[model samples]
Target: MPLFRSPTRCIPVALSVTLSLAVLSTTVAAQGVRTADPRASLKGGVKDAQQAIKHLELVSSTPKVEGWFNPRDLGDFGFANSDLAFQKHLVFQGGWHGWQAWDISDPKAPKRRAAVVCQGGQGDPSVYGNLLFVSVEDGGGRLDCGTQGVSDTVSAARFMGVRIFDISNLDAPKQIAAVQTCRGSHTHTLVTDPKDKANVYVYVQGTGGVRSPNELAGCVRSPDDTSTALFRIEVIKVPLASPQDAKVVNMPRIFADASGKVAGLWKGGDHGRGTQNSDRTDQCHDITAYPDIGLAAGACSGNGILLDISNPANPKRIDEVIDPNFAYWHSATFSNDGQTVLFTDEWGGGTQARCRATDKPEWGADAIFTLDVNRKLKPAGSYKLPAAQGSTENCVAHNGSLIPVPGRDIMAQAWYQGGISVFDFTNPAKPQEIAYFDRGPIDPSRITLAGFWSVYWYNGHLIGSEIARGLDIFTLQPSEFLSKNEIDAAKLITRDELNAQLQTKIVWPAHFSVARAYVDQLQRDKGLSESRISAVRGALDAAEQSSGGPRRTALTALATSLVQDVAASGDAVKVRLLSGVVRELAK
Candidate 1:
């Protein structure tokens, strides 16, 4: 996760009267209003035919050299409409190394103002006040939360959990204090209570770390430890001056009801480990707090969790939502109105969870879902990426925002191959794509490989984290046409129905033996042992056993070869394999 970027980041300013005069000058120039001017007319009203919304404007794109941690998420303070002297900056995790800040005052051009490198570099980041609290997944390679194969030689500095940085100064953000309290910090959010200043708190969710040898049966001291009960979401009250005041609070005692029996503890410590309301199911990946609602939502890997933080010192776990469809929830954000919670699944990047190829976007298993906290954390709706574009090895919408753009109804989302998409979620159940900017020259087929990590609307400007590149900024060009039917009928269909339709539409070529030969050569050349090679061969055989066996097998072989090629030779694989592992698994 050590990407080519820096860390921790934000700001305010004014020459008093001079700033006021400058703001007045700009406002007077903009015809007296602060917001972007509305279009004059809707020339062609809504019609029976669907109108295409086109993408306009490429503000700026920077190619990151020594990338920071993988840019996991992005956020803006008041850079949109306010006349803050130095517009708010963008705060993101530089891969796993630390936090990186960028100055985006000029929408057309952005400057990388600062980078804050800290220990335990991997995890999601969130900003509050002048402090940037990052939930670092640094457990000293001690826990096997899932990355069992990650090299043990990576330093502990890369695994220190919850490194607090003082980002008050934009130029040289300092790591004032470091806390190794949790086993591993997945993601944390700062909860600021306007009602009581003493109530401000930080919630850090630690997805259970590497299981101990005693816990995981038949497992040695490897990374894949499932038995360790270290997974928990912590509520620590913070003092304005020192992070040392951070202390864990008591959580609702939740226990795992395995087979109707109280078997284990909830994942989030006393919240119940191996039980019905266990927050530790897949490990807490994100903790989003809406202080306005006195609520803190945890995006557990396989489940969604909600907690009432009215009493920050001792939070209460109220309800939990579990959807088996998505197994890995990466990030969570509340809507502007603070009624709806949005969760993004990080499933499409060619891992076991999302095994699709890049071009075949159907297999790209990422999804955008909303839960209504106002109604007891009930799931309000969900919208998955349409499967018509084929499957992608690693494409899916990642960290995004419910933009405040008037009449746009667009939620700016970071799609790997899709680049950045502004979708009309006017109808929450069905989202319409209004505009999209695909990353230049990147294989669209491999859409889940962390191409664009985060996308957020900062005022009029749309900021995106292009993982392969650096930060990208864009301006939304208002479109005159209104598309009523951008929502595909296919997307509304049930998974079974979609699969039924795909059975006929997802056909492969009659012959791919030539490509198969090349794959064999590669396996041999790579010196894969007989057993490992057989494992691959077994995959091909297993795929071949499905309905579209021949096609699926050939596609699997091709994709496997392609991924191996890309990993080994750094060559782009342009192959599409919708009917491969994804379709086969669906069957």
Candidate 2:
């Protein structure tokens, strides 16, 4: 039987799922959705499964493109969908069998506009203007994007590292450049220096084993070797005017200690007998660069690092922290204001189930940290999927992006088969799950390595890269926790492009939605008195209905009244914010 319960329930794409990983063995099949939680015990299937959604609506679920998935096994690793990149009205979703471009102009019905067939394991991509950069780390990757794997121990035919494509024409993307690296680019982050607009920097994060010197000269790795490429990240400078000439510029040893030792970071091994054994901090699995604040949070193999990327070419490590509960530091996401950073731990490497009943909540979870003025990191708490899933589901904290909810630190994260969770982390010490959408399992009778690889918020909707299923798009629905005003405020913040690794600051305009969002937040948190809240809402409604002088006068009067309310309000900051937006609305 076909192995997939992904897009089967939704809309079917071209070509049926022909790949089969493992036949349904009665013993290895998913057992009962592990009904530890009474609220959710969804049935499982690769074609059709029971879904449990809350406060989020699935706008569309597109199946894998025809040629991309002749996946040999059930896990679908060879050609699984990877990370995502957005531009214009199209979403560039990376897949091992090259990447597919989906036109999301109408998110309700996303259409596959283009596909590039490049055989690689993890096709993480980032887009800047007309250039689309993809990470190629597969040993079989060819220079010409051929399906035939290169079997040479040392041959010029093999290509590894970052590939730059001119996506000026989406239907027919042309490869412009391929900058080879020592270990290949497992993932890369696009960074920028406010001082330099002529060029953008790509922080090449390679976690794969170092290539032989013959395969790629200058590539060396040894425990005692001083010139080893193991402990440093390669930075490629892509000139906007001439992206085809992009080349590796700096290989900063950000892990070095005060003694100038390149291998000064975590040396690997478990912190204690009960702790999760972690990998050594040699290379970064991923890096989230918030160029707006000159900060980048790197989830290195063994350490969660903070880098000062003021000089995009040469990032300097400002601080580093390690968690005993973490098995692997996989990815990071910074708060909108850069005051907080959340790092995910990919315990089972996104393959095995880590959200089982025996699993620890702290492991394979997201560790939240507060960044003080001195660049010091203080651990706040950790969050994992609240409900325990069955063993058949390979679930763990994978990839996610921040939801621009004005005053809140909310994130929409993918937990493999555990599903997509939207949580509020404004209070790092006490993070809470506000919304979630989870399907049972791929097979109720077998273990399958499939689910969301990465789910990110871009423009106004959440776009997810399902490992086996395909592209999934979702829109936030207003609930008690997330009000329509807040959702509207978030939608007001739009972007031309979005690369979760390279975060763009969310700036909401001076509109009535902004003021209403603040008002909703105030009422939700009991920040304002009910009498005052109703009065303010009435004033806002009157102002919104009027025009010109009448609206301005009404808004100004409300803003003045809010100044007096702030004295008695519990959440003065948000009240002040509401008043500020009200004043702006009047202007």
| Candidate 1 deviant stretches above 4 angstroms | 1-53, 66-93, 139-159, 208-228, 250-282, 348-374, 377-380, 387-393, 406-409, 440-448, 480-587
Instruction: Tell me the alpha-carbon RMSD of every candidate.
Output: 25.7, 8.8
TM-score for every candidate vs. truth?
Answer: 0.57, 0.93
The TM-score obtained by model 1 is 0.57
- Candidate 2's C-alpha runs over 4 A off are 1-40, 71-74
- lDDT per residue, candidate 2, 1-587, as tens digits? 01111100000112121111011111112222234563246798766988888899999998876667754564667777888999879998887788889998898888889888887558899999999999988889999999889888888989889999999887678999999999899999999778998999999988778888988899987856889989999999999999989999999999998899999888888665566777778988899999889899998888889999888899999888877667778889999988888888888777777788777666677777787778887666667787788888988888999888888899999998999989898987667788888888887787787888889888899888888888889999998999998998888888888887998788888988888888888988999988888989999999999999999999999999899888899999999888998999998
lDDT of 2 at 483: 93
Write candidate 1's Cα lDDT for 1-587 as tens digits: 11111100000011232332233233223222112111111121111211122464677766554534233421111010100111244534344444466666665566667765443434456555566566655444222223332454433333335656666787767665555543455555566666666544666666544433333322123323443234345566777766656555532322233342222322322112211111235345566666656666665554555667666666565665543334354556655454555665554321221322222221122233344434454443444343212233235546666544322235767655344656665444445566666533233223233345666555456667655455667766645322211111111211111000001111222222322322343343453445544655555556555545575555546455535534333212211221132323333
